[model samples]
Target: MGRWTGWVRWGALGAAVVVLVVFLVAQRQSIDVSYGRSPSSSGTVEEGSAGELSDATVPSVDEMTAMVAADPVVRLPGSIAHWDEGLVRNAIGDADVRILVAPPGLDKDERGRVRDVDNAQLRVLGTEVTGSIYQAAADDLPSWRAQFATGDVTSLLVTLIAGIRDQDTPEDVDLFRWRPPTEAETAAIATDLRATGVHIADGATLTDIPKSAGPAFPDGGALYAAFPQQTFGEPVPEYGPTLAALFPGKPIVVIYGSWIEYHGPNAADFTDVVGASFYGQAADRISTYDYPQANVLHAYLNRVTDVRYAGLFERPLPYLPLDPLRVALPALPWLFAGCVVVFLALSARSLLGPRRGVRSTGPPARLAGLTALAIEMSGLTDEKSDPALTRGITKLRAAGDALEQNLPDGHVGKLLDDAEAELDDTAWTLGRNDYRPFTYLRGRLA
Candidate 1:
């Protein structure tokens, strides 16, 4: 039974360990995301790897006023903003927008923060349900904005963001260049993010968006007209693939970044592009364009050959939120092994039982019964008894002798016989101690 108990404990622990391992392995991708943020500030913002984006700027938002142009939907990230919270909220609530909470690290830097803020607002055109693709330029966002703008997006809105870095690195061609993304370019970006060990939404992928400042996605419309009162944060980094998956056919409205504030003192015609679609105080607040970061460098590269251009950066640092074991699967066997050891260590008490000394006396049941019998014999023998009795007593004892053979394992007969002999010798008188050893004798024999 003891050996059986040990095996049971070990088996239980082993099973638990295996179960934990399987659960963790299944969540590997989620775990990878928690580690996305880089501690120090030093990164690059290069040209994107997809479509040429610099050449396309057709009927900029400003130029298309009063025009009801409809065609097969274009791809774009979906988000909208408004100056007044009440207005933006009421409007987008019905139009197409489910605001998502910002991750902590995002709200910190206003510059980088704005891209996310503006991008979130784009949900009006409905990036939420339609998949918003996140594109970055270089390691930043110039590429996403630059190239995305080149593509026609009458239906989607893009979230452009960048993690923090020390230098813009503009002086070196290695730092920032204008380009578009090829099929290979897009695949490479997606692959790298995957290598980091993170799981993404079913249809989403990470593009590039560099870190930067306020109004990152500002439409020329009045603040209340487009963006809500909430401060801007980083936008999604992987929206292109997501959008394509969500609405296979739709126009994509590109509301990307321009360092120029759409509503600021020194704004550009592009601001009107942001404003054109984002009119109305309630549900129609469009998107904004304000840039401090860069867009997907790979997408930016692709934009070089695109018909139009729009680039921005806005993803928060450290993208996904999963535990370590769930993310890094290769390390699983060792971790589960450790857990098995811990489970075994805690089970020793139950496996060994009370005899182990640290606990109460859980001695064998048979041995305990014998000890009780010995105590009873010692007490009975202490009672006074006259051995120098008449012939009648002696004869009576002899008459019952044959019946004594049937006594049990720890019978008192042997002790009683010894005590009788001692008593017979003592006769007239004697202390109880004289017969005590006699009882001990019988006990030993038994």
Candidate 2:
């Protein structure tokens, strides 16, 4: 009985330990899908309000210009040339700003421009550059947009190619002899531009211009003024299941540039930072001298500086909901460890606990053998007058009574009852002079 009880206790403890191990292993292998919030608010933007540039406390153009001209210019080979630095400095005067000259064709070579901006000592708020209007009108807009998107600035330059002459020789061209982009083309281009997060500037210029060309474009100033006040009515496209799977819920913002005619109708809707272009007859001459024209750079600086100084670039962080499973997953390891500790403590106690020795209540096993021996020895004597046989039977019956009172109620007790019955039968056979029972009993005992 004692041995059986010990086995049962050990089996239960072993089972508990197995369960704890399984739980700990499962927790260690579980997947978590939640993400934490970003510390900086720079790249993060809220949903549905991606392109909003509203701020009542925006600085004026003069204030923005002063702020922008303070910083040194970061120039690239393909960017506005070194010769044109004086023109840019003259326009910005002594304000703080970092200007990066990144042309469309110079993909990775533009790294120096970025580094220069980073090295500047001023409060470099943002960067503005003139991209090729021709390249943007073509399919190269995506790559250009990608380059600007990776920059620290929130906006970029989107030059317009509509109504601009593409003549190779500046002298033989007519400025008025140009065609505007159709409404369909403009809408399609606008959609694509928005997808790339490119910021557009109004008042584009002709591809070819002589040094004599002045700021004679009719819509140049009006386009610039209307840029900040224009709002787009087109709905942004859904990212779809494939993009969602790839990026989850990543944010996208598009910058737009348009002529006064194109965005004038919605000008009142956009009451935020506006972008205007200074590239026309007067500005084109300075930029055409194997370098980005000074007047064009100045105009870009003025507009971009205004936007930056007005605090329109900083956007709020997108709100991401906490995932319940992800939050709970982290606690699993701790819980598992605690359960294992408890199980081990319990097992240790059971193994090292003081044990109570079990005592037997039934007659000793050797007594049964002795009783059988006595019966066999008496069998040789005559049954009618055998006093030894009578005494042996009486002793066996007394042993049976003691076993019935003291033995546990199980297999051992049943064996005791059977032995007592056999003893009575032996006595009866001896009394009747039937020697067969005694003979069988003696052989079984032997």
Candidate 3:
């Protein structure tokens, strides 16, 4: 009985261990951390092919803004500072937009500029230029300043970029005399931009800027060629058509090295128009202008443009809160170890603890008697005159009789009676010098 009880206990423990192992293996499989890394900071720009502008009617800035705001994903360039709190609110409206910020490399003075922002529907990831913003969305990992709301980070990136650019440049250049990036430089910049996850239609420079109400700039200058109109801040209708053709269906970002007034009448036609100028003027305009910095003409242009082109890239996935299972995973091994220790302790206690005396019962006594009878019957010799054989037979008969009497008066009693009868017959056969019956009875008893 004790041996059977031990088997049952061990069987249950083994089953539990198997279940724990299976669960642990499943948990390990479910854990995935295969996020892609940022592209290397190599590659030079070399000009390639150019395409003709399509006559597709460009959406107005308001229309483009609405469209971008309605999209599931919107990718914007520049830091959080370029975005206005109210504009972000209006753009995102009721829907949740996960705003990821990958600022340029920071200097000591620019570090605090990327501080956490406040917005409930938005999650801000502080400056991580090498980190893939798309990966952050795809993996659903927590952001750097995940606690801050979207509004809290408003203009933070813009301000930081502006300040950093200002610090880097000792003097400002004349916008008219500024030398445009060469074809090779444009190609290299395009390559760098592509690494940041923005899709560049092709590595080509604008061959021509169609007719518009602006002065004609030198042709073959990638961005400058698109803006054939006078360098003075004015809407160049040709700019839109030229850009539309050069980079069809993609959001156009007009990046300028320094602050320049690029906003014009058809400015909204582009996805986003950004330059160091937009960020530099954001702070001063905040007090001069009643609206948020993003709502301002140039800032609005930048915002609307970003929204319009947001579709070209993957929509950033919302930031997922810290998982309870993930939090517990680190401690799971310790927990399992503790469980094993407890199990071992209990097993040891069971093995070493005081044992209770087993009371002798009728069934066990009868079983023992049966075993003794079988042994005595096997020892009987094939000699009828042998006194020792007679004594053994007598002992077997006594044991069988005692077992039969102790057994209950049911099927058990019947089976015992039959066995006793068989034993007696075997004893009689042995006495008559017939050993076959004795051997058969001994086999049956075994």
Candidate 4:
């Protein structure tokens, strides 16, 4: 019985452990989010392809603010900042705005793409940039900021050379005069000019580039060009379509170069306009004036353009505590773990019996028989007794004591049989002269 009880206890404990382990394993944190895409999306701005815009209905800034405010996942260790739509509109006139919320510790790759696209949370509210050049511009803003911040180049010219249209070329062009180009500058210029399909005339100076390039600059700003400090291995693919859109013709030269022999006027106005139009003034800031979030939204849109439709997506239930106990939400997991341990302890106790004492050995029947025999032997003795019988009774009492103290089953049975035979003999001896045993027998004989 004791052995069986022990097995039950150990089995219950093992089962409880298994249950806890399975619960922990199954409860590993995970989330699922699905986004909408445009029909022409390729997840990136491919070469020679127009950009695709997502048709997903992104919530407004106010709506998103409320949603994010309510979410416990992003409510970690910081105060939530609210963005006013009217404030943004006042800053950047009727432009698109986007916001990206990603898991903490994840960052973008060198190509200006989210490292984990599937898990990225995106929201957009405004007109989408459908042109590939515009999309590329948005994507490259981050890279451009990094390059400029690191002092890779002093100045760059993003020239848009379109066929002279309704707007005529300016007569007094604030052209940055040029001197003899260094070997490096000349080589960089030649390589960069190929992208715009422009070739410099032999023995021609940089001042004459406007005429030589066969295209007129819009409103005729500065008719100067500088080779770009090539940061990436290849120019971003979006630049082609961007130039194509601004300039209806080819030979639209965009170049980057160091401040080589500063002898000419600073074309800051021309360069600043181009930079701001493509990359915002403050490229790093999340405010509407620069709106880096818009770029993020555009990037996400391109990736998901292939999604036929966007709709409500089911998310895993968040582990948020009740509002009253919001302060304890962070400790909720630990609390659950503690509860599981407590439950296991209780279950084990119930299965193994509440008391912690030794289990029964199941020898009650044998012990009871020995006790009854001892009582009967005592009863056989009285005040009227023979010395021999009394001596015999004393011997039986001594044997009974031996039986009570750890006697083997075979030995106990033999002792018991001997005691029974003796008791019968004693009864016969005591009752021999008594008429009670032979009353009917004596009457029949008469």
Q: List lDDT for all candidates, in order.
A: 0.30, 0.33, 0.34, 0.32
List model 4 lDDT by residue over 301-384, tens digit each. Answer: 232222213221221222333454435445556655665566566556445432211112223333343334335444554443
How close to the true structure is residue 34 of candidate 4, measured as C-alpha lDDT? 34
For TM-score, candidate 1 versus 2, the one ahead is 2
Candidate 1 residue runs with Cα over 4 Å from true position: 2-11, 23-446
Name the top TM-score candidate: 2
The prediction achieving the highest lDDT against the true structure is 3
Error of 4 at 362 (Å): 17
Q: Model 4, which residues run further than 4 Å from truth?
A: 1-4, 35-136, 139-366, 369-446
**Candidate 3 structure quality by residue, lDDT tens digits, 41-99:** 22322211111111222223354345445653333333322234454354344544434
Error of 1 at 172 (Å): 23
Which parts of model 3 are misplaced by more than 4 Å? 1-241, 250-253, 258-365, 368-446
TM-score of 2: 0.24
| TM-score of decoy 4 | 0.20
Where does the lowest 10-residue lDDT sum fall in candidate 1?
220-229
- Give the 10-residue window scoring lowest on summed lDDT in candidate 2: 169-178
